[model samples]
Target: MDKINLSVTIAVITMFISLFLSFFLVTVKTEHKLSNRLFAFFLILNAIDISVNLGYFFDIPLNARVFISSIFFLQLPAFYLYVLSVCYADFKLKPKHLIHVSTFLIANLILLPRFYTVSLASKISFLKKSSSMLEIQFNHVLVHIQIILYLIAAFMILRKAKKIYLENYAGASMESLNWLFQFTVALSTFYFIALLKNIFKFTEYPDISESLKIGLFLFELIIIFWYLYKALNNPGLFRNIDSRLKLVADIVSEDKNSAQLIDSEKEYNEDLLKLKSYMMEKRPFLNPSLTIQDVSKDLKIPVRDLSVLINHKLEQHFYDFVNTYRIENAMDILRDVTKSKVTVLEILYEVGFNSKSSFNTAFKKHTGNTPTSYRKSL
Candidate 1:
């Protein structure tokens, strides 16, 4: 094998190994259904991508051609599902969902015969003296269609993910969504480069195909490694690191005869109740900027501890918990004849929402009815 092919092979192997480790680590460490399932799906898709690369590297046989062609079509839909899982924080696999996936698969099946026939024709042309221009043109057109379909799927996923990020969600969830968006963008860019290289293949470019393949392999390697690192590590890695330092300090201080401070249960309970009463009376969730940090400062608690309290005791994330309060207030407003002069948008803004779209989305999600529909029903 040439240096370029050897390099591409090593890169593909590294990506496969990283993906394998990530699959195992995520399975062991993550309990989140959506994240775990998405990682598993990514592992499968990465395997398919690697197989396709391997076939090109080896100039493999007709069977390899067919296998690669089939797997090529699998990448985009798997990626779309992965993005959906990250955005929603839920991976509910239903028959309807499977049906949607199968539709994409069916499209792949339609394209497969054309791909294999064209690949076979190209191989035959290389062996025989006679090859038609039409055969090569057909192959080129099919590949372009495949690239376009992949791009369309990726774009749709990105659009949905962006919408989810703009909606009120926990910081971690938002970060995850952004990460997926950036990853998809990177993948799209690499694919775009491949499309360009394909367009220029007939030109007398110096080893451009080899260079483009190596670039793609490196891109895949970087993405796989980055994603694996993020997935394997704990979500609150920095927080855990800080907690360990604090624990060591506590231990050393005890040995040094340092003063011990104890929190008073009575005072803590009183403060907790006071905060709850204020929230109930004033309903600060109506403030669009209300966040765990805001509440932590107002209530004199550490932000992490407050997050723990909400997640564990309240059984909801900060955003959902806050929105519940806002929706309750909205419900009351909708019921009041005195508030009949208030517009839906006015009520949405009054209750701490910055955007009518966000308010409508939250209202529908919480109540299973849009604000306008709910008001009409009332």
Candidate 2:
């Protein structure tokens, strides 16, 4: 098949898949309903954008085609908002969020006087000379700006969210946003390909530019199918941390030389003892889904204090601190002759670890041997 036919076929497949996924996300029951709905809206906007390429085949009206092309302005904002929703469970759509779509509204208004309001013959003339039109050039600039700003914003949000999860939650919670991270990486790849296509559009090689466009559609098809796989396999992937939670490093920076931050040696030792006592007696590490806040409440300590104690004073993340205790317990079980009949899998679960791979990793870190090797040596 020729380039146009191949590109059209891929676009059709991608749009249908994106539409199906969007509908599925909207209808699916999930704790992150707002996130799902936002992502579904993003997918719908993507479908609209893809439909822009097929307008010529269908003899679409010029006015309608011009209006639909404005969908480009909305795509990045919708995607950025979806990232925000996924990062924070408490995220809600408010009047303030409408500001994100201001560019899309402005783009339509800019087209109104020159293209939308013109007669049919004038509109045709405008299209034939659109590349030279100041309004069209300005819109192109806005799209490039959106592409850079929104994708960078999404990456920043994901990076911060991942850090918070690692510092405050157990090892099992580390991969909660892994799927979203992969999705963002895929989205970035799509934008990079588009950037290349735009650069090549003005070059001497027309065939190379057209080939890049077709390659983009092929990439889109791959991404949509990947999304389907992740959505089906990891339905509960959107676990979120409280957005208000601040990192221990930020807290320390604010009070770096405060007397309260530099507690008396006695008080420092006392807090350490208290934390160790609670861990031993309560075995909170065995909870599998434990977070620093959960331990703070149980110990009647402030989350900030607990964070400082474990994360800064102890020089370990809350995840690492908890897993250390879990690994110690697993070692004891591995050495115990009475529990020799118990499998390594059973011992890992009994000691509060949910995944065998993580359990084995922690075990190796704590002891220089795997669980089975450690048991056999005993």
Candidate 3:
């Protein structure tokens, strides 16, 4: 097939696959209903929205054109909700959100009567017209404005959320928002393509060729597949992290009465003392993959309090702080070679170091000797 027809084939196949996956996720996946539903809704709307391009390429019948405008209205809202559901489970669609959603409903309802009356040939002729009516051009501008607003709102939320996560958590392996960050970039690029296609319609300029729309849809296909790959492999990645972050958000945000006044420094010092006592007594650092949140929970202290105490006051990330304790334990075990009969690797694992390299590095830094050497010297 030629370049034009190739774009059509790719666009149709990609959109079809996207629509199919959305259906499959909603019906088959029980893990994250809210996230999946929102995602599926978003994709389905895109599938419908791109039908205009498909109509241009193939003579596919679009008997009812006006109702399809509703898909445009729903696209942004659906995507915005998908971000919220994926990023924050506690965030439900409140009545305030309903106000935004009503715009989609109203846009569709207002245009439905006029669109129903128009034939496919008229719609095609309107597209072919070098100078369409002002109303159509304005509507195109309004649609783009709506999309830009929604994209900005979603990106702001995701950016803030990612900032908060980085502040509270230290491990890269457990972080789930990395894909989300990339998703935002892809979505933003897709909007840029859409804007280019729609922007000049309001001007005296002749409408661009079907090639631009074809290229636009082709890029969209790539984005859809990328999204599908990430979503299918890690269906509940976002939901899982959302609930986790929510649990500790209060603790991580204000750090337990950040504004509470009553000898603030003295109170913090006292909490720090209590925290140190708990750490010494319980030795919770012996557990692998221990987090500040875990220690906070064990001490019945706010996660914010523990985070502030460890990260700010003690001047160590939670990872290093835990490993510090682990190294100390390993040194003690190394010195007590008479009772333990433990190997260096055993000491490493027992003290919560995930690997020997990390354990030796920590041990040597603090003790000036490897676990084996330290034991030998003893």
Among these predicted structures, which one has the highest TM-score? 2
Candidate 2 matches the true fold with a TM-score of: 0.91
247 Cα displacement, candidate 2 (Å): 1.3
Model 3: CA > 4 A from native? 56-63, 109-131, 167-174, 199-209, 240-259, 262-266, 276-293, 307-378
TM-score: which is higher, 1 or 3?
Answer: 3
Q: Please give the RMSD to the true structure for each candidate, in Å.
A: 18.1, 2.4, 6.7
Clashing pairs in 3: 251-304
State the lDDT at 317 in candidate 2. Answer: 86
Q: How many residue pairs clash in all the candidates, one count each?
A: 3, 0, 1
- Quote the lDDT for 145 in model 2: 88
Q: Cα lDDT of model 2 overall? A: 0.86
lDDT of 2 by residue, 201-259 (tens): 77788688889999998888898888888778866656787788887888888777564
Worst 10 residues of 1 by lDDT: 237-246
Each prediction's TM-score against the native?
A: 0.53, 0.91, 0.69
Whole-model lDDT values for every prediction = 0.61, 0.86, 0.68
lDDT of 3 by residue, 1-378 (tens): 476677668778877987898888789747568878888888888888767656655655544454565568888788888887776756666777777777666555544444435776776565466246454555666677887888899888777666555445433323356677678778888778767766554455524634566777778778877877866775545642334553234454554467542337887888878877876899887776566677777778877566666666666656666667788877777777484667788777777765556677668888788777778788
Displacement of residue 290 (Cα, Å) in model 2 is 0.4
What TM-score would you give candidate 1 relative to the actual structure?
Answer: 0.53
